[model samples]
Target: MAYKSLLCVLTDSDFLEAPLAQGMALAESQDAHLDVLTLGVDRSQNGYFYAGADALMMQEMLARARSESDDIEAKCRQLLQNSELRWACDSGVAQIADLGRHVAMRARFADLVVLPKPYGPNHGTELEPTIEAALFEGQAPVLMVPEDAKPITAPETICIGWNESAEALASTRAALPFLKAAKTVHVVVIDPPVHGPNRSDPGGLLSQFLSRHGVRVEVDVISKTQPRVSDCLLRHATDKSADMIVMGAYGHSRFREAILGGATRSMLENATMPVLMAH
Candidate 1:
């Protein structure tokens, strides 16, 4: 009752290379399909993200873009050749690139997506157009990768941010495959309300659910006064040496989710490990 395939969408950017490798390894471990998709967002395209730029900006951007694209393809091909998996790349049609919109379009068919976090330089934010599109427009589970994601340990452990919400339940169900692979699993819920005598049930039905599936589950109860679940979860992950994070994504809508106003957004922006989220 778990996913049998994973789509690893790429756009020839260096930022995604290592994360793609990590995603591929994850897919292989799960016995899933690894589909590599590319959208060469052409700087020359009149309506593309690069179209409204200056002349010099366009030139260097395209050069780096092509170089990154070439590197992504060659590396992916090499990795696929040596591994026992089905992997391939999609390089868009002709010279046109969909950039963020393209990636967003293909996101519909993927069980989960993995991409690199953007960094701003000299006051310029790395929140490139594509990242924005995927986070907001792409209606799929996406895993954002930090800079140093290569040594991401599989056998260590992972944490799931839990709450009584649809998104949370979806995230938990989708994360079963990964949780089953971890050496340890923690289903962390923070700061439950002070109970009256009528509240007979404890706050760990989710933990019991995973336990039924054979996951090594641990429950944590923290301060309700802190008012920052994201900070609490991140600290917990660090303390427990969690390699990946599993949490339900609650948002009013997809477009508004990327701004990441709540603890979930904070966790995603500040996550040291790969985050698995489903809308």
Candidate 2:
């Protein structure tokens, strides 16, 4: 499976038509094949085996989830089947309990995913749980959009939070396909006032590298004087009207370490826009 295609996510209702449209636009801009997926999560995957789900009831529950997802999947496909799109629905073979995992597994084959912003003070309370699962459990870089947004190329002003870490590197690498394709790439280096040097310097280094390939690069060196770097990035992205944020996910082995130096944890907690994260 090629990890170069785009995946669009949807709910059973049309309240988020804007995100669907943007997802389509995102897919077309990158010359990626588009796959629209709608999910109706039944039981959490955890409950199905170890100690929760009733085995005899599993098949029935899975069937109902598929039935619910089917209509939305069909509607999404109809809405996006113009000449430019090669679209399909995954309401084909699935189980509700495993939908999140399946989406994550299949996302390995996709270059990116266009997801509706799972949280907003204004969205219907009904969609929250399903969205939450995708945010944490789905293993893809999500291009989350506003509920009312129209289709668009990723913002010309792109902000990448550069840190020397695996998740960040994965995010950087995943974003390269887009970065190389973007009209403008802004590398923002948030500097700690007391620091000697920021480790990665991704914006500077990547800008120079992409310039050789004809991409227009801009660099914004910021001093992390106010708020933490994570919050600063969010503020910068909003202030610049940055279309997307690219950054690494920071993680540590033990429970103690995970809390001590996890920037990804911070971003995931506070991010309010389409953030491309790779872990």
Candidate 3:
């Protein structure tokens, strides 16, 4: 089957346009129903804890947030109106953290979720929490669009960063629909383990599995020493003119922080093409 339902998360941040356009384009290409979830902050609830002075300042903040939210909502509606695709729009008013959870809950019903790649450190807004929420809470594959991405289209060439991790398997399975449709599927293994349970012929098993699904699969083993695995993966994708990169997301424990795996973070920061990840 195909992606019959797609969820897109929108925010009043700098990274909105590309994902908005891509989401609509993707939904149109797949003939899928699109759901757009926009987030707004509601500070009214903070009134219970505020004194006279604090209450006045809080009211100003709330007013500003409300105005911003309204404008963003209108913009989203206008964008959707311009598109002929089947779409629905929903908005939530909550703290940013809770807003992410709300989006995640809605994402559970979707076949795929679309999001804008998080800005690099020093770049203003942060959206990784939202991405994390959607991936973990929704338990779904996420398609992250770069700021300069072209209008979405069905991927013709796909690169799978193979490591045989459970997350990688989940990503591959989630990407099967695209792989089966692609003209070429490259399973790229970088600096694979020489001998281990996970290294029983790196990429061979996955290639075979994909071949059985009628995909034109090829296994590529690259021996690179300098750049990181994530860098090599991106290089391979570029060299092959891949339209999409499907891989696993890595994460670790961080007290009150969303600390992502090195490879996953690099891919999110440096990828010029759409990266599909599952954790």
Task: List per-candidate RMSD values in Å.
Answer: 4.4, 4.7, 2.9
Model 2 has a clash total of 2
Model 2 segments beyond 4 Å from truth? 1-4, 11-16, 44-63, 82-84, 92-97, 121-140, 181-183, 192-203, 225-227, 250-272
Best by TM-score: 3
Q: Indicate the residue-level lDDT of 169 in model 3.
A: 94
Model 1 lowest lDDT segment of ten? 119-128
Candidate 1 TM-score, true structure as reference:
0.76
Q: Single out the weakest 10-residue window by summed lDDT for candidate 2.
A: 124-133
For all candidates, the clash counts are 4, 2, 0
lDDT of each: 0.66, 0.63, 0.80
The pairs that clash in candidate 3 are none
Instruction: State which candidate, 1 or 2, has the greater lDDT.
Output: 1
Of 1 and 2, which scores higher on TM-score? 1
Superior by TM-score: candidate 1 or candidate 3: 3
Off by over 4 Å in 3: 42-53, 121-126, 198-200, 251-261
Using Cα atoms with residue i matched to residue i, what is each candidate's TM-score against the true structure? 0.76, 0.73, 0.89
Given candidate 3, what's the lDDT at residue 237? 94
Q: Would you list the rank order by lDDT, best first? A: 3, 1, 2
Q: Could you arrange the candidates by TM-score from highest to lowest?
A: 3, 1, 2
lDDT per residue for candidate 2 within 1-279, as digits (tens), equals 123477765654555476678766766666667777676556435354746767757767667667767777767767876547666666544444545565665566666777665555655333433343443566566665656555667467678776545666567677776676667777777763344454445355666766776667787878776656788888888888877788864344424424574455456546766677665
